[model samples]
Target: MFPTFPHRKWYEQRIDTMEELEQHVLNAHFPEDAYFRGMPSADFICISSFYRQYLQDNKDSLNWSEQQVGIGVTMSLPEVGKQQYKESSFEILDYFYKCLRELGSKELSFNSIAYLAQHYGLPTNLIDFSADPKISLFFACFDEKEWFTDKDCTLYVSDILWHVKAMMPSNQTIPMGYFKHPTENRGMTEAEADEMMFNMFTTIDKDSSETVTPKIELDEVKYSARIHNQKGVFVYHCDDVPFDRIMHTSNCNDGFNKVFVINKELKPKILEKLNNEYKINEKFVYPDVEEDPNLDLILAAAEKTKQKFDLP
Candidate 1:
């Protein structure tokens, strides 16, 4: 099974200025040399967004989200029973793969499949994150005033080096058996991996197979340039415990879980600093736009793409 989580919430730091945040990020423990001594690639920051920290995505935690998706019956509704939710989650995944196969996606991994679904606005267990620190900052300041009742936003910066080392104590490269990595280490074909995942994903207890984390092989066919532009990575949920839970398995103190508090009053200034000084924005983060930086806004305001976007 996968390693357990380190649920020990450490003392969080609140920085008043972007300068302080930059100094914290700029001074992080990144190995200076790489090519000379065969040093591992330097650790980079990864970020997860929340309108409010209390409303986190706890284990496909869409069930725990307080936000509304604007659909009639609250598409945000959770399942009635835990068992029913698990069963339905697996079934929905199977349905998604079937649709992908029908649409000519051959031998796709779970991460790739889920990323595609997320981009198209489907309700899956997947949550999105970015590797770019500035991009993370962009998300931190993005419209919390409107969507979250004028609430302050949060940005969680995890050091990837600490995270991977914690997850794979022996080998930092060990894959979490999503769809790409199976437990048996048998050289199974993609279809075989699919079947194996179906069994593992549907399991109810602490079975060994339940820990698999099927991700893209070599991550080359990782399915999205929009994702690539952000230097994105993901963690998919399986029957076994997730990587977050395992971080607290011991008194293991790692640097990957740093939390930052961004005040709502500073948002306007922060946005200006990021957009004008750092040159980061919706276009930089989402890179799929033709030319307009405000294409998302344009589309939403237009009659043609507005309804399709489910805009009110």
Candidate 2:
């Protein structure tokens, strides 16, 4: 569905040093804000950091790449294959919200349920981004051990609401795309209605005329206290999108955005600057970083260790 053909070279810029990386990523200014304000898109522009510049469409899902090799699940299935990907997502969301409602948040909507799932680490295709460049870089530099090579990381800038929808799938050939759900006087196509049916979840962007409230724009939703603090938003992804695909294919004029391969050695320096200068340590990123969530994480690890050794 990336039908836009600008006929140009791939939009990737490699930053060889931390000094330059910082200026472009952390310190750069948007000269194009006036243009951005006029677009029909929601300002879903955000950054994501990956340890490796080449990792694309690396999503957490029912079938993550780590488990795919042995399972023989390929992305090449027919329409049913498409439906399976879409349906499983809906099923997991429904199950999670059902359990929550039983526990008493009676008014959860589908969008809220998806947000909860992603933040709590349940498998879904949503990827995280932040309006703040530093927040995105923090993730890139997180867990020094997970930081590979000379401390190299990549920063991605994307307008997810634009690219993901324009590139959304219409059939098995494409396999990954968004379903058009109308909120106005217009009637739902049978397929669109199905997408909204039982799960009732939608990231609906309404037209100016629609009387029904638009589905929540994920970019605007404060899904949780932790995400709210991190300045995070979820970029909905379909199974077939490679992490790198957005770089070369998005049709928007301003979409070339920025690309950088940060110096590996700079990881520690940046991490230190962030935690000490901006106070972006465990407490900020993890929310009460030293409290319940982190302790729970440590406890879970301890239980796993004890189980492995058959310790009493």
Candidate 3:
């Protein structure tokens, strides 16, 4: 089914049957650097749950900022938009790392914490993809609950690494302010804040000839049981824009990124084949393991982390 709502669809091809969907995957040539993502619906834009939630939460504030200010009406919230959110994301991430550290994860990197948080059902800026297209197919056919056949699902294919390397803007300097300590008593003076912000964000020009890349492909090191089982990889815009938005605005031509829209009617058939034939079901994709001991502590840490951020 074609989506009734307005959404960005790229090089979208309709797959009418299970055989056709398999044939497309079989016949198509995926580059060595390619990554695949699947969604339960065609209309879903490629964005992280955290970013999506943030946008939804501040929809009114965002709209207010976009409109012209009128007499006697004040802008109640600080201007909230994509850029500001991106800046705030860094601080939030630092808090997650600190939280994990507090829970005895001293050696874990920020990226590792991000992967763990995502797998554990926490909202994060990381978007999951798989190196194997078959895994993507399983996800497209089955939502976590059950077979999602109400509408057409999508399997998005792209060499995102290639796209970023070839098309992403380079050498852009951005202000990423410092995260305040929990026990900090005094507020930073204007000059101190400016200097700290400048130093933190200005490290990019380390080499005059080198340029910074905007997209981060998280390392392939297995961070969690589920992540390893799923052959999971993650991609995120360093600037915090949706990956689709970055691809849309780039100068590159089509075919680099493709979307296969599986027929809604064929979802059940596809899922069955995936399970019985390919052995790519939930049991296979999600490995059974004892729950993380710090699950509650981590959750509380996340709440504490968010509370520390003074986002408007």
**Range of the 10 consecutive residues with the lowest summed lDDT in candidate 3:** 205-214
When 1 and 2 are scored with lDDT, the better candidate is 2
Best by lDDT: 3
lDDT of 2 at 63: 38
Per-model TM-score, in order, reads 0.55, 0.58, 0.67
Task: Give lDDT tens digits, candidate 3, residues 1-312.
Answer: 111212235467889975687678855677786779888877775767676657667665554322222223222222446556665555666677777778765466445666666665556666778888888878887876654558798888876554334321231233222323212433655445544443333222212111122222244243355676677767644433346644444434656667788888887787787788778888777655453334465566667665675332
TM-score-wise, the better of 1 and 3 is 3
Q: Report every candidate's CA lDDT.
A: 0.43, 0.45, 0.59
lDDT for predicted candidate 2 compared with the true structure: 0.45
**True lDDT of residue 204, candidate 3:** 25
Clashes of 1: 21
- Those runs of model 1 whose alpha carbons end farther than 4 Å from true positions after fitting are 1-9, 26-83, 159-222, 238-255, 289-312
Q: Name the weakest run of 10 consecutive residues (lDDT summed) in model 2.
A: 33-42
Task: Give the number of the best model, judged by TM-score.
Answer: 3
Per-candidate total of colliding backbone pairs: 21, 10, 0
Please identify model 2 stretches exceeding 4 Å from their true place.
1-9, 31-80, 144-151, 164-223, 252-255, 289-312
**RMSD per prediction, one decimal?**
11.6, 11.3, 11.2
